[model samples]
Target: MTEGTDRPRIIEYAGNGFVITWEPARCRHAAECVRGLPTVFDNTRRPWIVTDGATVDEVVTVVDRCPSYALGYRTADGRWRSAPAGA
Candidate 1:
């Protein structure tokens, strides 16, 4: 099911200030994202990324905190998500 298709899927790599994916293989786990944004990057939360943790706009800000591009974003219209400010 895609956006505007069936059911709305949960946003992945989403967080307050930014959204990102957990590329296990690519993830270096340098704790940069976590250190930068704890409220949104908590490990306890499943999927680990809460777009609603703050605001879609806010989440984009934090995801940029990630030194590595392991996390990403785009529009919610089935398009790949990207960080805000074009980070």
Candidate 2:
């Protein structure tokens, strides 16, 4: 959680081969993640982001399409691909 927000600024969902991080405040509702991989990014689900729903490669590909960079991933090897400056 950030300074004044009740919710976390970044939420993490981990799986076997990778870990996914989501920044709700940074999301622009473009739906690229949901459209690209519904099984993994289904907002209807309790946790919403389920990394086990898809493979590591699939998750990475879809997350990269995020226009606002609200979605990011960290590989098992500890490589992080997060948001850009000001995003």
Candidate 3:
């Protein structure tokens, strides 16, 4: 765990083809991610945001919906991938 008042703590989860980055301090708990992808973003579960619970595309889609910008992702090669329109 990380602690700081000046910098947000970041947690990373790696999946088969992508990595998800989360910033808890930046999260507003808006539920956009939960609404978009329940299986992967379940707040009720420990270590929420199961990177492998869904496909890379699906994860990307939900992460993009995070209103607080707390969620983000990059491909295995370190290229950022944005969600498709309407995702």
lDDT scores in order: 0.55, 0.86, 0.79
Predicted candidate 2 versus true structure: per-residue lDDT over 28-78, tens digit per residue: 988999999998888888888877758888988899999988899999876
For model 1, residues 1-87, the per-residue Cα lDDT tens digits are 556663323345543433455544445677776776777676677756555556555455655566655665654434444333533
TM-score for each predicted model, relative to the true structure: 0.52, 0.82, 0.78
Cα lDDT tens digits, model 3, 1-87, are: 877676557788888899888888778999998898888788989988787668888887778778767788898665674334443
Could you give me the TM-score of model 3 versus the true structure?
A: 0.78
Better of 2 and 3 by lDDT: 2
Report model 1's TM-score to 2 decimal places: 0.52
Question: Could you arrange the candidates by lDDT from highest to lowest?
Answer: 2, 3, 1
Clashes of each: 16, 0, 0
